[model samples]
Target: MLITIGIIIGLLIVAYFAFVNFYPSFGGDVSKERQSQYTDSSQFEEGKFKNDKDVPKDPTFSEILSMTRKFFFTKVEKGRPSEELPNHTVDSLSLVSYHGGTRLMWFGHSAFLLQMNGKNILIDPMLGEVPAPHPLLGAKRFNEELPIAIEKLPKIDAVLISHDHYDHLDYKSIKSLKNKVNQFYVPLGVGVHLEAWGVPQDKIQELDWWQDTSLEDLRFVCTPAQHFSGRKFSNGQSTLWASWVIQSETESIFFSGDSGYANHFKEIGEAYGPFDFAMLECGQYNKLWPDIHMFPEETAQAGIDLKANVIMPIHWGAFKLALHSWTDPIERVAIKANSLGLPMIAPKIGAMIELNSLLANHQEDWWD
Candidate 1:
């Protein structure tokens, strides 16, 4: 029995080492490259990008392991969520080109189908049922399939990635999209993982904070997001995490990928402010990682930071990434924005919101 136990222990050590070595540590600019055409990082003054020390202390693996393991290994918890299919069918916003031009369809979590200037962009596409590589390691997938399936998706022009967290970056999603995606805009070390998953080196575009490039008529600027990334050990800062600015002739959109409160928004707003619409993060927040995520109130504050005229709360409403009631985010954001007189829309799942005409009439508590 001791001999058998010894063999098992040896295997675990090997597996653990493999995990550490598999993902590169967060450190350098190996996969990240700077572009010469990129000039001003942001239009704002100093202190725009919040630093690491300001970010809230994340739950060390030791701090949350028991809960994580119990949740993962035990069946005491039901495998699925209780929320029903949201009644909001996506409102079809007509594109300038029926095929494209500044429109987005949220697929849940931080993923969206963004079309601008005739280019189809997919952002942080995590359409998988579960965020884990296998069912054994993580929580169950969101109860609903992405409003649209990957296979059925129209040809994509590019993929904008925020970071390497399993929730934001799904290996299975990338693998399936390898042949379909024309280009990938990702943070530094993220390309390494994508390469391992069968993505080509030429197709992946890595940008540092504030770097940007033009694609066709659409322009993509990688902005800073206050967050961290690591799918495995030793890769804490290997890859960067950031938001994105999508701009075109008729419309400009700001996406706050996953960030805590920061002064960068004002800078972004000034530089790319007066956005027609903004998709802001407003979910899975807790006091533990306070600086990494903005509370529902803070999410609204972020909208103001980007000077968004019409805003829709993403990140929440899709996945139960936090312990709050499923509806807490939308409900709280509605209350806060209403009180602050912030122009906002809380569309139900799949609901289409038209930015051009909302001042006259809009739905009330549809999610309620």
Candidate 2:
């Protein structure tokens, strides 16, 4: 019986490997020449991307085994919402007619729509029903429907991708938005995946850390994030991860694309901060991997470090990627923000928020 169980486990491991490595949805291959271009970057070394700071030693084989065992054996009943969370949908047609100041719409997790300088921009647009390569293979989205259907979205001026993680760079969402997007802005080597997905080469702009690009009146600076990247195990860290600074003439916005608490936040603040609004990751964190994701308190602190006037906690309320209760992130973050006297907003999903109005009408505790 023991021998039979071992054989079955080995076969399952091989099958899982084959699925992730060969799956088209996992994303495109990075060529040797493409990797060479990244050699000049401080974060790229030994042919793989490296974090700004060294973390605790990579999880040991025994530690990994223990975690895997617990994952399968543990009962996490509150990890997801019991019912579909409520959301407000916006009319896409109205968005096109009103040429106005900066406004934003959240679609749960890290996906957001930012309208600034009369341009519509999408950040980390993983709009599909699942964060995996296929809907059948992984956890489904917490909500059964999106606030706005992909086909109904207005023409996107640009799509910004922070990394190639399945949750942040979804395959189906890219295919759906390809024809409608005028351009794509992504971390270095991430353009390879877009190219494979039928996006035009001329439409993709890849940037290294601290590199800035312009799209009409908006200036985007690809900043650092303390995180790793990869869709498949074999191609781990072949691409870069990042945070972003989106600046218009009158306002600056910060988007913390998946990161742990790090000094980089302070450094970014000094360089290009005093932001009008900031979005910080505040969910899917675990003690085992403390170096990659931040606790809710850390999320609040990160906003202060970025010198943001108002902070909005994101990266929660959409998926069950961690063991914490569905409401833990916002609940904890709200407490931390209050204790620190940080002005924060937990906008209802799909609520259209204007940047100028943030100071006056941002504190709506819709989750309660």
Candidate 3:
């Protein structure tokens, strides 16, 4: 009887490890494309980037364990039921003029399509069923229907990614979007995943901190952000994180990718700020991971740090990544921004927000 019990226990442990070992591609050095993206670390160590089980576990695993325990064992909060989405159809809104003006349309979460100087750019698009490859883990996306399906989007000029977090760069989203994107502008080492996922080498443009590239009248500058990067546990901090400055002759826009409170905001503000409009990170924050994601109030502070005239809080209203209520982020930020005299745009799931209109009359409480 003892031998039978031991044998059963041993098989179960083996099966668990096997399950962990086999999963969505880790984008590690496997395929030829992935190998080509590898940079020698002299400091490089083998098995530095892969899924969680094989990598160095977090130093504060106890904290993560405690949090997970509380979430499963104790956390039981209810979300207030929102109004049923109004009956509507996607509008065929024609472009007014791209002479020198800029406009932004949110697709919920951090996916945005920015039109300026007759070009379209997408930022940090996590358009997939789940942020992670598996549906069982990671937060579910907020709006099941994207603002517009990727097929309906106009010809895209460039795609900007801030980091390699599952929430920021999704594999299925990239695979679905592979052939359509004209150029992929990413930070150093992020090209590995894109390459692994089949983006052509020529299409992947990797830049370091403070690097700038021009596409017609607009320029994209990769600036630093106070954040870390990792798709799997093995590669924590192996790649760079950043914010981007998009500039044209008459207007400038700042896309604050996922970041924590860092003095880097001031540096970026000094370099390419006084922006006409800035899309800042404003949700999925918690005291546990405070260094990576900013709370609602800090989102406002970040706007001030960037010298932005008008700010639109993003990274919220899309997915429930933290323990807060669905409306907590927007509600809290709305109040703080008003008190601080900061302008904010609180649009619905897929509303078109005109830059000129936002700068003119700013009282569209569309979230209600």
Candidate 4:
């Protein structure tokens, strides 16, 4: 009986190793050539990119064992929505025809369609059904359907990726979008994955933190976010993670990709204040790793720090990456926003949110 148990355990370990190694969705490595490009960056030391602030210390072996045990044994009933999440379908033709103003559409989680400066921009578009390299490895997305199918999307001007995490930068979505998108703007070291996935080198522009680039009238500034990145276990921190400052002549927007509360928020506000809208990450958080993902209260504080005219909580209403109740993020953020007198909006997934009307049409609690 003991011999049989050992044999089964060894096979399981070998199978898991093979799956991670052989999976195309695990993405490509950051080559030595790519690492060379980041030599001048303060965040790049030795080989891997480093966070501006110190991240939480790596979990000890004992902590890892405890976490693994708890993860499999713990009962988590409220971590996901009970029923299929409702989402509105976007009219692709109308979206393509839209002009004269800035509009934003949230496809749940961090994926967004920003129609600005007469251009269509996608940010962190992880539109896959699951947030892992394989479907069976992670929680499924909450919605049955996306607002618009990938095939139905309008010609994408640019796709901005924050990091290479499966939840933020999906391989399947990238493969589908590469042909449609005119360009991709990503953080330094991230271009390697796109290159591996078949994006033309000319169409990809990689930037280190604090670096800014312009495509026509729009300016994209890669800024810092306090988070870690890795698709598989071995390549952790190989790519950069960032928030972004996207500015048109008339309006500026801040996108907090995924971050914990940090002083960088105030620093960004000081540098580029009075943003028209700020999309702050506000979900998939827990007390065990509080320094990596912000709690909902911290989300409100981050908005305040960014000096945003209106704040829209994102990184929720899609996937259950943490142990909290599915609706806890929005509920907590709303309470904090009210207390702080911060203007906030939580639009239903797929709603066409006119940038000017964020404060006026803010009270729809569709998650209820």
Off by over 4 Å in 4: 1-14
Instruction: Output the worst ten-in-a-row residue range by lDDT, candidate 4.
Output: 68-77
Q: lDDT of model 4 at residue 305?
A: 92
Clashes of 2: 0
Per model, state how many residue pairs clash. Answer: 10, 0, 2, 0
lDDT of 3 by residue, 110-185 (tens): 8887877788788887777577657887556655566567666666789999988887888887887878789999
**Could you tell me the lDDT of residue 152 within candidate 1?**
64
TM-scores for all predictions: 0.81, 0.95, 0.84, 0.96
Comparing 1 with 3 on lDDT, the higher-scoring candidate is: 3
Tens-digit lDDT string for candidate 1 (208-280): 7778888887788988888877665544555568889888767788888888888888888988888888888
Ranking by TM-score: 4, 2, 3, 1
Residue 309 accuracy (lDDT) in model 2: 94
Q: What is the TM-score of candidate 4?
A: 0.96
Clashing pairs in model 2, backbone N/Cα/C closer than 3 A? none
Tell me how far the alpha carbon of residue 98 in candidate 2 is from the true structure, in angstroms, after superposition. Answer: 2.4
Q: What C-alpha lDDT, on a 0 to 100 scale, does residue 297 get in candidate 2?
A: 97
Highest TM-score: give the candidate number.
4
